[model samples]
Target chain A: MNHHPTEPQETIVTDMPDRPALLKRWRPRGAVWLAAPAVLVLLLALAYPLAIVVVRSFTDPAPGLDNYVWFFQSAVNRTVLQRTFVVAAWVTLVSLICAYPYAYAMTIVGRNLRLALILCVLVPFWLSGVVRTLAWVILLQDSGVINSFLRGLGLPPVKLIRTLPGVVIGMTQVLLPFMILPIYSVMKGIDTRLLQAARSLGAKPWRAFLQIYVPLSLPGVYAGAIIVFILSLGFYITPALLGGPRSILLSSLVQNQVLSLLNWGRGGAMGVVLLVATFVLLAIAAPLMRQKHSSTRREA
Target chain B: MRNFAGALALTMTCALALPVFAQETPVAGAVKEGSLEGKTLTFVSYGGIYQDGQVAALQEFVEKSGVTLLNDGPTEIAKLKAQVDAGNVTWDVVDTADLPPYVHCGTLFQKLDFSKLDVSKIPPGQVGECSVPAMNYGVIFMYKTETYKDNPPQNWVDFFDTEKFPGSRAIDGSGDPTGGLIEQAFKAAGGDPKAITPDDIEKGIQKLRDLGPDTIYWKTGAESQQLAESGEADMIMMWTGRAMTAAKNGAAYTPVWQDWLVVMDQMTIPVGVKDTDAAYALLNAYLGQRSQEILTEKTSYTPIHMDAKPQVDEITASFLTSTPERIAQGYQQNIPFWVENFDLAAEKWNALLSGN
Candidate 1:
């Protein structure tokens, strides 16, 4: 259509060559310069401290692997680590179970109702972790509000404070927002027309949701689950406040070593192990995340 | 550029010359008026009402000595070790448990100059080579009056007797394994409390385990007080000060002072402090008669001054460990034994806590 483009061709030939060369020369340098502050911050704040912890695990009292050896050999440490993972998994699963319907409702709700639902999810996030955990303590403690209500109903007072169920309840409440927000964000982006079309094609509502909508919304579920799990692994305050001595997690162990015993080597070793375990979990989840992202892109 | 360089050089010269000037100044063994002028001392302690009382006790010193006093937090031994290791000690005087001074003496803390500190007024044996007693307190058993209406539990043995007590129990689980707990446990298990050793630690822990699943652990003074006030536990082993506070807060509790564990907080100068003499002067001022009296009145902790008498209410006086009768009934902690066996005991304590 533009075969006779003599004027445009002359302008393009004159302008394109030197400008691109100049841009190409400076672009990479500009990018490096722009990224320098973030890189420097990471090196100073994150990498340096992490390196110190790693080094301290080996060399605090003496230069050896005795700390790590002790960590593995100690039955207490092993049990605590196992308990930490188990609690984290339980919190993740519970958060996901509760967050799924709430997030799905948010995706399909009216504007005002959606805002209200979002506020419900976000208000707890605004509170401090310590304050929230303490609130749970007040509600769950013996002679606390829940126990008083149970007593009023002629029921025996249950041991809720400093128990496993108490910890799960507190952690689930704390991490629910983490699960809901991610799923809501992803669910909001999903097309509702696909579900409607499935229903129009004679599929039942439940069938349509299960066959079409749930599959599409899975990336969000995976993201929420991973995030909640990782965050719950490092939970300190909730478990400390709500869980009993038997509910001591790995973080508590680290605190015990570093603070009480003043054994930095053992504490640092526990920290390194937790960090490695977190990374391994992330590494396993990363491939699934990437695959889901690519499939979503292809569908789009 | 020349002007800036000249100014920088002059500043550096002044910075290097100041310490020399300070060294030439006469050191006052006593906290004389304005002796520590233009100096600031950072006082570190376990924060809360205790630290508030400490700050209150130091107010007179701050006024008289003109040393601007700054306060810092819940003392962490690891942080202190790091500071000492790095030669960057910021805390001039730290309030800590009695055991740390004995454990890290001459390394993390300075061995005191007895001439600078007026140790004559303090109780004998409360003074250490590196530390001086800050305040005296006790870890005593306090039970809900309603739970044991006619026959109240009397001592640590009754505390361990779940069948006799027949209620939930709470104990301090804040820091390292406390020697008081072990001593009490040993006593309860029919072992001699005075003969508690690293060997007896296992049996003590076993006795605690026998107390069973109704045992609750409180990590803070406030939590222990709350445990008593809220009726979360029937019997609470807590500080005398906290138990008093709980009673003041309307908790119907009665104290069992028999074999109560006598504990004391100690103050020590960190190793590489900026001003050693000033820190010693501060410690001296803290042990003053007026300061100790004020501390005892403001906080329910017992005063270390041998002659200081605090005008406290009847309730407060009932909890004070200073009186001769109460002191006779109390048992002093085996600080050296704990300082030596801290690590092993801590490991076992953690293992038991984690239910392994």
Candidate 2:
């Protein structure tokens, strides 16, 4: 906390007479050049396709608002949109519920043991999404291993395929890694001494956890929720396979529009709608995320 | 008669043209004796037997033609559209399902020229101005032969009658409204399958919902086979290949080819393919009877050529709509009707599948 402004230092590189002008002129320009490649990549990968989608959504196959209108008016499209939100909300909630305990465990575990646990959490990362999804098929089908084991014990087999439960189970499986890692990373940095301190002061373990650990780990929770929710919204395969007839998602609809219907404009419109919904969620998340970020910085 | 003279002259011209066409075509895809092939031809096709048959049939062509075939798929139309938009057409030919070519039309696929190939070799009514039917598949009802040794469900009507069958069945959960199963159900219930109106589609879907809680939905061809193999499903409305595979995998199941929906995979050049000559040569090779016959034997799929006799076992031959007797019962999917009412059909189909 040395706040002394007592010493004035002489500039060593004052050989340039216009040093102030030179510094002012060159710094932001240098930063811009440094950022140019990243900006260009983003433009190429993200912005350009998005621009095309937006354009196509507006001007394709007669250049009118018909595609957008079709999306809103079509019962199938409306149902799919509703289903997407429902699935996203459920995934976020489930991931939150499931990850909290694991995240808490990561905090209290020994530092050496935490690395092993973290590795366990990340083991699925090495497998392709399609492979993991195929594994879910082997596990969840009517006569699959899960049902067979259940039935062997004199229990009736549950109709797992083409049901909402199947979709949620498959999706939660696909996105569990996304949910766990962020929460674990945040929890690991929490000062557990505060919980011990609270306990020493006669606070119960649950209360202390609720007051200290839960709030502290919320940045990770928020991050994990957004990651899970956003990813779940765009889920294509799991919902298409495992979910029942009525459980159509926006991604599947976009595929149907492009492939089955052969209407690119309609597909593009659905894509833009999906993108905008995600963007809106992210936009709403920004203020809370910024506040959490600041609280994290302050805690640090 | 003028028709006789015209036919004779046409035959004479084609006889003269055949040798030239055959000789000049493969040279475009000419192989070097002991040198590496320079270019890669990307092939987009549906997975499993469809791809297996196609690649197997074209193996000799690849050896002779010297064009390296880069296989890619479970063909996604959205991916094709994206690639086209990006100005990167990776696939020279895309062997997709029946409905896509009709939906995308000239935008996604090129209008094919039949004059380049010998059309007389092909079956009647398959050569389209825009597309050529490459292979035939049927969507038919299947049941485990062991399930009802004496009282087996025989027809589409029996498939819908849950009371008599008293077991779960598998249908596609892909939300394809006009998926062959639903259409068959409609037809079995005395709705004219060909003249399916919006109301008829609704009725058909209601019939599906009635079949209801006992129904299991399979998403992929492999899943359908697994359903049959595991014996969870006593019966299923399945694609022909899956039914064939299930039987091959020692499942005691057999298909009811009666009133089956016959579908064709069309081979058309996409609108902006640069290698049209190579595409044409590939198309010509694909039309050859030897290739078709060999493909039919290995894969359960029927060939497009009229002259090719498929070498199939009794069970598989019984299952195939291409068999003389089964062919009579099966109906060709009316592409014109589908094309005309595509937008409406798409919307209605989606609604029906979504249970709206």
Candidate 3:
């Protein structure tokens, strides 16, 4: 680990030789062609279709923002959107709380146990999200294996399938690796001597771990939380299978609009709203992420 | 003596079932043994066990006609429309849900050339301008026998009586609301099914809403079937074919047939598909007696052909929606009404979904 803090850059852009030299240093002109195919594919496959969706949101069934208006007018859409955010937030929080300790454990564990823990996260990656969700459905349904076990213990069976908590559990399980890996990598780089230094000086064990270790791992926490949160917003299968009607989220609403109602304009409007919300969220998160991460890395 | 009687019984059953077959001597849609050699027609359907059955149904045709049939799709209208719009249709024959043929008829889906295809053997009034019946099933409900034991829920009115029935109700949440259930609910609330209006949809939704915390809207046929198989819900409204599958899975349930909602899937050719004759031949073959029986046996959907007697098990036989008694009791969905006010009804259905 880089325990020696590096000095800040002393170079200034105003002292650059010329525009051409700076541009060359930034990126060579000849290297531009190498990115053409990827850019073209992105434009055709991603941007072009996304543009049509955005445009259709405005133009279809007569131009203007009527589709968005229609969407907002419906209480169902509002509740679903709210539910989507609430569920995503819960999934992120739960996974982060569950994952942090595990990730921390990974940093401290011996090689064999670390390998086994890493296998725990990576084995699930082999199964598709739908397959995993279906397995969860089988396990979580009424009179399922879980409930049967619970009943065997002489306790009332807890309702997990078709509930918000069930959806959160399914989603958190699926998204745990996203949370764990980033935090583990960041924790691996942080110097343990800093924690020991705090403990030796005056800080108690809890205070030292909280004050020294947590602040340093904030960057990984932010990275993982952002990924888990954003991905959860668009989750369909997990909630659809594990959640009841009360737990319907925004993606399923979009699916209902486009696939069921065949209302592309409304569906496009929902998609555009979700996209804009994500972008705005990223914009707000980026500066906070950068500032805290930079300050934390400096301390480390 | 028993073997002789069994043979005699089989012969008599075949004799009775071959009337429609007798009328079409050369088999109206049959081509010469190798007429379609080197030609390939792509068949698209909602893939899985159902699509597998469809492929099985066409095997005889594939062998006899030498036409290579390829399988693809869980049918999406947008994909079909795109192919037709681009005039590069790869999907030759497409099996779709009930609404698509009627909705996209002459635009995206081709008007059937009945000269090349024969619909005489298919059920009357089901031959749409652009399509023929793929199979017939119903939006039927199965009640857990253990839950009801003695006082089983008998009909739609009882479906909503949570106090009497007193268990969870799993309704079909497969996008569009089932018109049969709506009309039934409306009728149970002292409204006439034949005179159902836009306001009546709201009434029915209210009836469903009254079921309250006990109601669950199962999103897919498989989900509904799962509800039945596991007895997760005391009563589950699902497709007849799915109920059959659940019964096969050893679900202990009794199907309430008081007014099993009439339903069917349709097969249509995309407008710009290549090799229309080859497609027609396959469609014709799909309607034949042996093909219908095979489709029925494999998929558990009742055949649309008038005289195809599938040798199904007792469970499948019970689930068949096309039997004379079931048909007499069946409540046909007001398709014209539904198609006209689909969006408005969807608004109410969505509201009901979110109310919980």
Q: Is model 3 an incorrect, acceptable, medium or high docking prediction? A: acceptable
Q: Report the C-alpha lDDT of model 2 over A251-292, residue by residue, as the tens digit.
A: 877877777666778889999888887898789878986776
Superposition error at A154 for model 1 (Å): 1.4
lDDT of 1 by residue, B1-356 (tens): 11323443443444345546454422222468998899999999998888999999998889989999999988988889889999998999999986888778789888776655566667656767678789999999888899899988988889998887799888788767778888889888999967777889999998988888768888778889888888888899999989999988899888899989888999999999989988988988898888999899888899999899899998899899988899789888777677778778888888878776
lDDT of 3 by residue, A23-94 (tens): 668985688789899999999999999999999999987999899999888778888888888999999999
The TM-score measured for candidate 1 stands at 0.90
lDDT of 3 by residue, B1-356 (tens): 21323443453344346655565433633657998999999999999889999899989899989988888898888777667767899999999887777666678888665556656677755766667789999887889999899899988989877888898889888677777889888887788989989889999888888887657788788888888877899898888888888888989988889888888889888898788878888888898888989999999999988899999889889888778899898888776677567778888887777653
Top lDDT model? 1
Q: What is the C-alpha RMSD of each candidate to the true structure, in Å?
A: 10.6, 7.6, 7.7
Segments in model 3 whose C-alpha atoms lie over 4 Å from true places: A1-41, A297-300, B1-29
| Poorly placed runs, candidate 1 (over 4 Å) | A1-35, A289-300, B1-30
Interface RMSD of each candidate, angstroms, one decimal: 1.1, 2.8, 1.8
lDDT measured at residue B318 in model 3 versus the true structure, 0 to 100: 89
TM-scores of the candidates in the order shown: 0.90, 0.83, 0.89
lDDT of 1 by residue, A131-244 (tens): 998899889999899999999999999989999889999999999998998787767766677778889999999998887777667777877888899899999988988988
Q: DockQ scores for all the models shown?
A: 0.55, 0.39, 0.47
* Full candidate order by lDDT, most accurate first: 1, 3, 2
Pairs that clash in candidate 2: A162-A244, B110-B269
